[model samples]
Target chain A: MADRPVSDIELKAPKGDWRDAHVELRKGTFSNASLPKDLIALGLPNPRKWQPTDLDWQLPPDWKGILLRGMRERLAKYRSFRLFMDVCVRCGACADKCHFYLGSGDPKNMPFARAELIRSVYRRYFTLSGRLFRSLADARDLTEDVVKEWFYYFYQCTECRRCSVYCPFGIDTAEITIIVRELLSLIGVSTHWVTEPAANCYRVGNHLGIAPHAFKDALDFARDELRELTGLDIEIPISRKGAEILFVMPSADYFATPHYYTLLGYMMLFHEIGLDFTVSAYASEGGNFGLFHSNDLMKRLNAKIYEEAKRLGVRWILGGECGHMWRVLHQYMDTMNGPADFLEVPVSPLTGTRFANAASTKMVHICEFTADLLYHEKIKLDPSRNDEYVVTYHDSCNPSRAMGLLEEPRYVLKRACNHFHEMPAKTIREYTFCCGSGAGLGNDENMEMRLRGGFPRAQAVRHVREAHGVNLLACICAIDKATLPTLMDYWVPGVQVAGVHELLGNALVMKGAKERTTNLRGEPLAKETANA
Target chain B: MATPATVEERWLAAAATVSGGLIAAHTLTERDPFRNPIGHVLRRNLAALVREFFGAMDEAAIDAAFGEIMALRSIQDLSVERAVGFVFRLRGIVREEAPQMQPAEAEARIDRLAISAFTQYLACRERLADLKLNEQLRALGVARRRTAHRGGAPA
Candidate 1:
């Protein structure tokens, strides 16, 4: 019965990355002058000033027994929190795979080491022997300083869940990261990147901060792509009732440069199949970075989809190939959003086999839907259109491991391209690596961060391309668009990346469509500027 | 854009059409779904299937067809692990009835779905898999914390 919950802690600014401190440590900086004198020399705020030397710290009534205990109890029951507390085997194999590790060479960046930061605290607070006997697990004092460190490194992690694939015991650090972040949020600590998007999502339904007008224009443009490419009067139908499906996707697709082409693929394919689908402006975002940070935020972000789904009276939800977005649906949507008996299993029209768990509004990956359509004789092909070069595939991290969508895209690629070649070493299925930019690290503010993160993946791609003379990279994620080519230019110089949808669109020979304007090399030409 | 809808409504409509239409036509010397009870579950589900397969089905198609699947009660709520078999079987049924489907197209499509389904399937199977993975991670964290307390035990 812990009494007196600590209320009103000050929220400090972000420490950015522990890597900088880690680099300094490697240089033998901290331990060397950490002698109390160094604090005065460095002009750091002195503990002597902050500590309450005059009186004893008393617990506030607001922070007492039931409320705080109830919070802990509730958190302990959350899926990610519970799973985070119950699993993990500290193997360091995922060390080199982490971008922060490669970028900073900090021991703390190693996925296992980063997890160790919070796991140690959890042990003392939650474990049996830890609470009474602080003998072995030296649970550090839960001071304001500890809170500071938690805010710093926690945001540094993107929660990609890539490490879990290689763990012999299959420990997912991402889940732990989520739980820790949630705990931090409980103390009212906030990060600009995570909380800002979550707040924006609550207001505008997108992570990129696009207004409803811009959103409408983007949707119109996606529709225009369909009309131009298919030469059919296909509508980027919005809110049409009695519609068969709702293609709820990332608004980034509605706004970003290269990834928008993937949206074009969706528009073209829908026209070809005469499919009745519409985008819901209310819940259009597919990326759930908030999920990677906090379960509460995840629940908040996911709530919009259900609200929109009920409002529109639609059956199923289909996802784009964004990493965290798929992660939220595949991993946590059911646990959070349920009573979904209205939606039928997403049975592939081509094979009639149900997609994922059909019982709960079976969600399908865009790539899986596209590939399956091709597999069950649903879509015709014009593979000759992709004759310009040999193509290789890069499995987007979440779709590859978290969602199990690696093979579907490859199958579609093989049929759509005459010269398809698999990238070598840890490519495809579970062994696949990340796009170096999954989980929101792909933005311009994080450009240098993206390049630094994409190095190892770039090497893997280069090896395969050089060995096989492959020049084109077909990836199933938007994150790859921003990071891959930059990485390729630096490491693999000549290789390029494109979305699987873009490739399929290239191979799709629309019967009544006008002459194709797309180049054979398959790179998107300069954007047509509509008089802004 | 259209107003939003829940995964439940999406699936419920599809399930109702499939179950309702199947029930109605089960007795009639029936007509194929596309023509008969136009709103039949099979046809509606097929519409969803086609939309999902062809990668063009918009938000409305999602509500009509796979919305039920999106909203289907998770295996976590139920005592059995039937979503996997049901979904796969449904895939088979749609594959049988769908027209204009080509073998070469099916081959390519399955190839794509194989990786995504295995890696990112929204089916409860992958969720459970992720849970298992999460369990493995936390356990290791507990063990490490425990060992560190006992004077940092050797690996």
Candidate 2:
């Protein structure tokens, strides 16, 4: 057992001429199955041991019935789902827009083809032309093989909505992928990379399953590290009721590298501004892996934030640098679990600027908050402190596309760093390529796929690295912080990944603070000084 | 003796042949490295490999060049034979371009290079397999430590 590969699935390289043969469906590229414990904990069906390579998935007896009914239910429920199902002209506008398709050269990775995998089934089950004349109408029955294909291709999508940008009909292929994943979940088919973290988030209030005490310990460790770096006792309050604001960040900020530096920056910034904010261990996480899994799970996980906010009696929520966290907060949070009548519209206590945009959600992005502070000249900044890094910003997909947060992060980056360069205009802003590991596809098993998906982004980074001597790739997403380092190391070495706030934390000129010898990572501040 | 230009031409011919119909013509023609990474990586590394072969015969340089090529090919759908066969194609090019340059030594060097390519290929495959297990263990370890800190049993 130990001698065998961790997964029985093997990668099948395309045979003969690849264009002629078409890229074969590789078995292991799909993510690992959700563990029974996580499945049960999430109340997901069929809580049993299984692998994607397993011949028998041990699916529910009436999985086909369940799936058809699931399709019928969703089509009736979401107008966008129905419109998308009915809309795509298949003019192939989005065929070349996908990074996955471009990198893998797999025809199925194309957004339309991926959507067709489900749309075909949807037609066969629901539509009249498809019901009577299945093959003629390009409709296929919901066989196990079809289900398997849906699992393979749908998970391949990062749901970055890049394809939707190019579609003349504005067909959101990502919405199709999400609906297909929801259908898959009806029969107990899902990935551990997503489901496990989701279960952990549900059970322990964070994806890493860090309990309240451990969460506190991580904060305490960061507090100590901050003290060592700068001679200041930064206060990190947790679950302190009656605070004016509630601070929420992806749990990775506290637990993961490079991300931890961003956390330290937040601590320093909040301390400098003297903002009254409290962190809640119960709502310790901002990232909702549930967004990747299902809407119910997304809601269940997201509910904790507003619940914690109300309990702590904070004015409004302040979010940290995360991608999909912003997506759920911006697009879905208000509708799913909102009308936070208890909390006031967020007014930056320091800047006196109200976030009129977040009037309904009442949750302000950290970049917006900091950008406001910089614009008002409320905070002292030393851009030279980040002189060592030739920085470039990677607009994480959700923050850029879902929320249209294009300039705030870059605005903050320009003010915080001495030098800043952007990737190709096509690859930045709304058109930004995904980290290739988003939508819970960042599992180690899926490394090759992630590398392939990440190729375009890495290729863009490589260009800037050679052209501008850009060494630091800063972003505002925890997943990007966690995964871009691996991507950079693999494709373009010498380029480091960091959060925008980490750079800000380094350049922040805190009042009454000692001269800083090192940046937040505890490395020396200046390039020449470090070399010496 | 073959000039650097002639060696580079021969190398490009061999790589194009090895690529077969797998890579798109537009992708190969695309000048932007970001738009056509596979083409860029192939051109850069293959040129470096040939240069290292004729000039310094630097083992490390040859290995680094091979590593980049194989890193890509290993993930691709090409079989082991086709994946490493591109190395042997260079032997024919070397023979045709500079027949008088000690054919026997050149053939031996090319054979050794092919072996190194195979080794690199296997290493990439091994890395792919190990990635899954390593990631699982890493996550488990973090979870276990956190549980331990909370005075709970191993998760």
Candidate 3:
């Protein structure tokens, strides 16, 4: 535990004629070193020395040509990318909107400045004015330094699209970032943090590489926990064919803390409603780290979910709580790998509810599913079971911004807990901030950057903590479950973090169950412990 | 132009100039002065700092005001000189406006502010460094756990 909780507010001082110095520092367009071994392990095609600070990135002789050609190909292929390249006026609305800029004070971290890193290169190669009058047009030739800048700043972006929400032209900087990352990957310049997971998800059917039997063992372990907690015999169907629904979740839920409790929540909910669902060991992961790497890889990993759903002969897919997973599933999944003509649109078996929102994708969010059940009062909930916590929901960037899943989680929270408060309006829903470690940036090497980027979210969390005396920070993102605990421990100590379903697991009234004495973490309940 | 007939009026006019200077110094890098939250913070903190100089502002209030100012500035690549220099800007104003006020007394107050500002700025920088270190350690811990899971040496 930290000796004292840190606040970003205590560290500011006046600029006092120091703008030039700071501006010069930000213009360098460099990043802290990347490890060679991690890159090697990920099998990124390059023999370069991995350290960014070394300044010798060890690119191929034709690296400039490769990057330029890749950019040209993308300009023709993606109309959105080309339009984004053409439209930015640098009006500076997006300058302060980026959490990275607000946190790091690096001008390059500003969306406009970050775009210029690529736009400058785009101008020099693609535009007539840029080629003829380079300096005046703010264009520069593609060089090793420019390539290094791309590698550094492009990775800094989480592609949360908060900047787009505020942009007058409605330019999606996230798409621009995706294009740059795709262009960079052409020359085999990619981060190990991203590529490693993409490789793992490709080879082993999950990011963690948990084999079929191992995946079963994890489900079985959750079942045992359910038995011990609710004293109910819960059967977790593993790759069972002809099940009514196919459930897919981030593999982290099967493996990590807070998330595992959320997994328990799913089991308890399923058992309570007596719904038939199958968990697939084959499509064991819903998270596509390939979204962070390239679009093709995202499509490649996403194919498994539909394939597993089809093989199982399930009517529809029910996705668990995750961040980027939903972003791909909601926006890109159908277009990239679908027409899901084989699968039926999702409807709840117990509640007899049809999910019209998810009719096209044939996949329903577990929150939407649970929220429907609660709306009709199908499942009995003991709201007092979660009296121990005063909760605040963090709108995970991808889910809130990409999917507009703002209401469903809050509905679940309203039914599950007695006390709930929202973060400031500007920071939630469509304008939500990233977890600072999203899009495969959640590595130890980039921890400072993450902490800095996370400050806006943490600051809002702190506000509710101070104002409402809120203690538990509830969010839907699996990465939030793994990472926010660390972030809260550092930034807002005393604010415990949990998933919404973890609260649901606690509040759930199971049939013929013994008197519950503890919540999902096995920490004693207030009533039972007080009586004891 | 007509001059202020009284020393007190002259002092009040000079104080406005100092506060304006302080707010301007804080907002130099901000692209949108009105929309930026930090600009508001500077305006607020400069208001409080000016109050502390002329009014009976408590030590805690002074500290709280500086803390807000410091937090807004924390994002910048701040040096010790740049971080606390605004606190010293008042010294010149005090000497120029209220010469009747004790120079030693005013210098002492500025010195006190400089110390507070520097201490807060250092703490912020230290916390940033610590966060980076902690993140590396946490990442290493995760890596170690992964290694252990791979049937290698335990973390």
Candidate 4:
């Protein structure tokens, strides 16, 4: 690491005086330098070392042509793209709603302002009013500064769609960000946090780039840990042919802390229910970083799951707890790479419930699957096992807004734990704040922005922490599992982050299992108190 | 004979003027803590600082209150002077609110608070720098481990 004093670190201080605070772009909030190797290996255009702060981004000579052409193509193809561009009226309903704006107090971080970075360019090239009136119509010529602004602001958005919930015209600002990012990718303006993960997901089948053996080793480690805690030798099938269900999750589930405990939860739950499922090494990652990049790349990376399902001959798919994975799978997967007629409609073998919501997609969320199980009383849960935790659920953005997975995780959480609290009405469910690090912004260099963006969510968690002595934050997204821990550590120091399934695993009562003394983390469980 | 609450209000008003331009007027006035965490953080910390200065002069409590505000301002797009200068703004508020208090003692306390605020601001900046370095190292470590598992040269 470079040994530089904190005072010496260059911050992109906002230009002009404090009155310009609204448009002030902070230092350290822009895209990190993309690794040349990752960019080159991915076959991205103009693969070279570039930082967002550089004066000249070394754009292709016809960069304007590329952006306009990309925008025109998307405008013609996606009605939502065209509609979002044309519909926004500069209303500020979404201004205060955005967690980034609320956190940073930067007006440019507001959804409308962020969209205007692209909309102004869109107007100049595509609309007649912009062509004639230009500056009067609030349009500007597409310039390098505009492209740099796009790279900075678009990456700041998690594409969480919280703004869409508040838009009167229902302009999906997240889609605008997506289109702009796709356009920027054409000029090789992408972040390492995104490109590296996209490359890994493309080649190694997971964002962590964990090879097949390493994937198995992580699972094996979880299995040994589980056995030590529960004394049940759970079978974790990998790429088993003719399995009834093909299980897929964000690679972090098996590889990272907190998410690993959720992995154990899934294993124990599947074992208790006697469900036949196999995890595929080829389709190891459910979370698609490509969604943060370009649509074509997203489609390319997403094709692996159905292909893996076909190769394994699984009847249906059971997805693990992931935020954007569900967003892509629920919203974009079938349209992009589907006609998944090869797989059957997902039916819970334990509860005999058919997931008609996932009929066409043929993939059921683990929370949905578990909620169905708990509803039908298929798995016995000892809620007291989780009495030590006063839990609060954070609705991970994509899961709540993009996929409308509002109640299932909460339903499961209620059954799995004795003490449960909700973070105030506005901050949960559809109006949920992004973890601030989602959509490939979860990298280390973006730590300051992440903390700022996550301020709203952390503040809510702090509310419940003080109100109810809540010490555990439960969520159903893998990114939430990975990032909320850092947010909680920074803001609400005593609170811990855990997956919903991890909590359920703590409360699960497996037959012939050893007397449990601890939760999945091997932390000793709260001793039973006598009331007699 | 201003009560503690009255003095705290005066001190907060002074701090707000220094930090006010950083956020919108509406956001600075937003009562909802979750909606305007920066405003909430500022109000909460400034109040705590006022209480510490007027009350028992608990060095630790005063340091923590200053640290909380500085932690936020350090990460924001403020120059070091603008970030910590709010502490110095409290001097006039203290003089007007407590005329019976010793001018020399109050000045000494305010001076000490300003220095502590600057120290806290630097510490927070260092924490941010460390966070960046640690995140990069963590990512590199993960990449290296993955490469080693694949029996390839480390990435």
Candidate 5:
């Protein structure tokens, strides 16, 4: 039973070519999606390996009703609905903003067009004419056929929240999409990645199927890498209760490639600042995949983070800059799991400035934290040591659009490295395009469409590489870490992807530790930030 | 004679839920997307309504959704405004007859019944799609002029 997770594994690269993905998508046949199968599955698609063995649903039964009512009423009452309903003139100002529309030339991919899909329902359900007459002006009804179409398209959304940024009224359709996904979960339907990790997190406490011993071993690996890279005896301050900070990172880091190295970078940063931070084996997973499945599961998955936080009695909780994780944190975290009292909003000890808006817990993005420390001159300098290659930044969709984390990362890169190149505005900073793989679309199930969507962003990077000799691409989100390698290798050849914190690790002047490898040791030192 | 609400009010009342400016903007233009957008709006909304109904509503979720609907205390206070322009603009003989029948109690009941029937009809149409089987929809008859949906997934 213990080994069930390990034996039941299958990780295939997404099938089909991405360019043709949109073509197949337009036809509803490209991904070979099965509506019936999806409807029957509970988040995890492949039940044998993915089905959670942990029956430990430990809910108080009544808590489910409270959460459901709380979220439902809040959504039903959100001001954004009114804003979305009232805002768009449909002048098509947003027609070109979407990566999917630009990539496929499909007008339906327009953000307003998608919003209308929900807006129309809102009209039908709420208006007197929709209710009392055949008036074309009001509400509509939910039909089974309508369910299938939503299942198909809602999954396509990538939930980028990009549309919200450009919407003059701050209308967030991503909320609508999340609500729809919650509704879908109620029907016992879910995709594998969304459900699988959620179950893994609940069952084993880590999404990578790691036990405590394995988790400890991963930490040891990071420590050894720290020794080789920094020539220092840096132990990852592992799982100690009553620490000042409980840093939460995506489990993918502990189980996968550069994520481990990114962890090492944080450890070095923590040690340098003389802060008390601990990793938790109880709630090790960062809970990004929670939003991908059902909001019911999203909340269920999110609840564990606070549960552990309280159990450990930490003053501050730091989160890694993961894409969906930030989306949940920035957009829904406060509304769902909040009133976090022990933490006083992450303020840099060096800068005396707040890490982020109080709305998204006082937690700081690693880049923001590192940059603040640098700005305050808390770290010793050797900025030009990373001068070997020109670099550019891929502003991840979540940090830039969802939370407006544009300048802090660029600030870090500018100060940490010697040669810095900027991608065109459309590809960098606030207007930065999504990596073709935002959302779970990076999966092999839809990799074909992912590749196509990735084209424009890849082309943007290609231009920087050709025009400015850019070799390293720094982004803060871990999902980007998993995805950009493919994008750079396939489209923007000769460039590598990295965490902003990583580039800082190379030049960081540790008090007790020697300077580490140029790249954060998330992977072996051989894996340069450049494309393989 | 009971006066009905203006067509604009009837439209805005519900259009108020999703977006006001977009709806108001559409009100200014004769060819607005709400009335007739480039893609099929009716199909799109119907899909969303179902997605919302099921994705968010179990029996408990439905009750919660219903509770929310009921919670809008103002909705109950709203007077059912008639579309006087629509009544006046009715085609041919009915246009003249509708105004002529003015204030008759019988006409008012029929009008009320029609409103109830229409609202119920929209809900019935939606539920038929949700249940899908004819036997499941024993109350909604094929003889009832009902349209069979293509089920929206790839045929």
Candidate 6:
């Protein structure tokens, strides 16, 4: 019977103030369950072989009590959590700001609704008004079902904070998501994707769990790739004492593609300028998954960078390209682990450009350093080397909205590539869409959700692809470089993705370098053919 | 039962119904404002698909509309019954709105559209899987190149 039920369909919009729209809890909607082994690997205390979608989540006997108590503890510990739970007037300004809502059309994915998922639960448990008038106050009891809802929707958020940018009261869903996750973690109810990385970052000082010697070997491989491309052997000192600057990068940059090429670019730039920098094997990773989980976990993983910096006796720290890594360094690190009065303020060695913005943390972004280097005419560049790529810059969420790093990456992209195009005015800079794979959501099992979350971003990229024939999507975030290529291939075919450093690697004119036939990925340069 | 008077009302009613279901899937757990860009596209695509299936436009137009829907649906975690169910939603709309429609002919058209839409959804799904594989391969390729360079390094 192909008589698909389109009859008797009465379509009516929710009435009487959209904020009072009926909240439904339809079962079987969320089924992408987290695995038990992943939880165990992340060092979570949960029974093995128990999945989230199962009728029995194998949660502790007093799970409901644990969650309520945990929420109460967090509310006291974190003022932002208490303030965010109380301050929302349901104004609805932030409803559409979430890329998840824009891409998925799921009203629950809306930032306001997503926050309400937790706020409603908060009211039922904590506030007297909520207990007095449950329905009117939009409060619901914390039940087994409510815990399941938390596990499903809280993990869906990339915690990009685009909503906070537009919120009148500056209510941050990212903070809400983080606190909810912390409460979930107290009950041993968290996604394997996030916990596994947090576990690895804690134990190995990197997310990929690469060992010390293996990390060195990967850097050695990158150094050799640089030597092959530039014909100059650049020394990459690892964990060397008395190095003036301690350089830390996302471990993905060492082992992963497109990212590795950018790693090579860093080597080339440091080699060209003869900057005194040392990358530590211990402080190998810059991206922190702990930020996605809890504030204390973030500080635990982030402490290694400063630890290595002080151990190496470096004057200052220079961080490589990443999204949340910068967010942690800029906003959280100094507050959590600092009085890094042990380290001096960072100044660009080539141009003597003091990073006034990073004076407190004493960590400078590589883009800021490179942009300053280019501004002072320190490095020789040939923009035509990247002529094949009509580039567009993607402002990563943490970098732009969190740290206000809007212009530095574009400054580097403009000088490194011949043709640069900006996406729609609304989509670029402060209003940038996420790559849909940030905050430890870059797992293969959840590709469908990731793609949905990534659609608004892919749509903006598709805009530039059609308008300017932009083949290259350049960004400063390592996650963007890793994930956007896949997003481009799926949504807008023919668009390539790379980091700004990869473009710089292609365009940098190294001294005594052999005649080049290829770009960073070992593809032949389009300009080389024309020049010949 | 009587259908709407004008072609515009008929199509608009059909679109409103189809998009309303698509929007409801997102609100399975909670409800908020029922407006979004995805809903707008779903509405437009439904109208365009109705036009194309009835020979007002070519198959390319149907394909384009289905392509957009497939892209949006692919990212959603929906089962086969749910994912391709929207394509066949037009069958009831045709039964309601189309004047003097033969049930057999309408079923055939709806079946054909479902098959085409399913094929499009599969293609998008396949591309996502392949891109993931390609990403792994690309990382391997970069690693291999790095290894080769490391070996060729002057001692």
Give the best candidate by TM-score: 4
Write candidate 6's Cα lDDT for A367-392 as tens digits.
98999999899999988888888999
**Which 10-residue window in model 6 chain B sums to the lowest lDDT?**
B26-35
What tens digits encode model 1's per-residue C-alpha lDDT throughout A1-532? 0011112112232235322222111110011111223223222222122211113222233422332363377555765555555465565577655655443334465787777666665666667766876536544334444455555456556676666776766677777666666665443443344545666677788776677776776666555546645567767887666676778777656665456667777778887777767787778787765774467668778877777776777767677757667777777788788656667677655467677554674667777788778877778877766766589888777777777776788888898888877755554567665555555444333343444355446656656776888888888765576557655654465786777887788788766776655532233322211211
Q: Candidate 5: misplaced stretches above 4 Å?
A: A1-79, A82-87, A129-142, A345-356, A511-532, B1-155
DockQ of 5: 0.01
Candidate 6, B1-155: lDDT as tens digits: 43322332334333332212443432222222222445555656766776666665466777888887777776565555666775666655667767576889878877877877888888887887787687776655455665565575322
Which stretch of 10 consecutive residues in model 4 chain A shows the poorest summed lDDT?
A1-10
Give one digit per residue, the lDDT tens place, for model 5 in B24-60. 1222222322122211222233233223322432344
Cα TM-score per model: 0.63, 0.88, 0.83, 0.91, 0.64, 0.89
Please tell me which predicted candidate would have the highest lDDT against the true structure. Answer: 2
By lDDT, is 5 or 6 better?
6
Native contacts matched by each model: 0.00, 0.10, 0.05, 0.23, 0.00, 0.35
* Best-first order by lDDT: 2, 4, 6, 3, 1, 5
Residue range A48-145, candidate 5, lDDT tens digits: 21221122312233533443454456456766645565566766666556665444334345778766655555555554565665225533444433
Candidate 1 lDDT, tens digit per residue, B35-113? 1222233334544554465675354554434432322222111212332223333333334444346756755554543
lDDT (10s digit) by residue, model 3, range A1-532:
1011111122244345221211221321233333455345545556355655554567777888888888898899899989988989889889878877666656577898899888888998899999999868988777776777777678889899999999999999999988888887767677767776777787778887788887887777677767888888899988899999999998888877667788889889988888888888889998998898788878888999998888889999999998899999888988999878899878788777888888889998888889999998888888788888889999989888898998999999998999899988888888887778787777666665676677677878877898999999999988887788767865677888788898998999888999888998888886776778
Question: In candidate 2, which residue pairs get closer than 3 Å at backbone N, Cα or C atoms, i.e. clash?
Answer: A13-B77, A14-B77
When summed lDDT is taken over every stretch of 10 residues in candidate 3 chain A, the lowest stretch is A1-10
- RMSD vs true structure, all candidates: 26.2, 6.3, 7.0, 6.1, 22.0, 4.8
Q: Which stretches of candidate 2 lie over 4 Å from their true place?
A: A1-28, A527-532, B1-31, B47-64, B89-113, B122-155
List, residue by residue over A37-118, the lDDT tens digit for candidate 4. 8888888888887677666778889998998889889999999999888888887888888888887777678899888877
User: For each candidate, what's the DockQ?
Assistant: 0.01, 0.21, 0.11, 0.27, 0.01, 0.30
Q: Give a tens-digit lDDT track for model 2, residues A1-532.
A: 1111112212333345211212234544668899999999989988889988888889999999999889888889999999998888889888767888767766677798788877787888889999999878988877888888788778889999988888999898888888889989999999999999999988989998899998998888777777877889998999999999999999988886768789999999999999999999999999999988888899999999999998988999999999999999999989999878888999988879989999999999999999999999999899898999999989999999999999999999999998899999989998898889999999777788888888889989988998999999999998998888877877788999889999999999998889888898667879549568
Q: How good is the docking of model 1, by CAPRI class? A: incorrect
TM-score of chain A of each: 0.79, 0.95, 0.92, 0.94, 0.80, 0.93
**What is the model-wide C-alpha lDDT for candidate 4?**
0.81
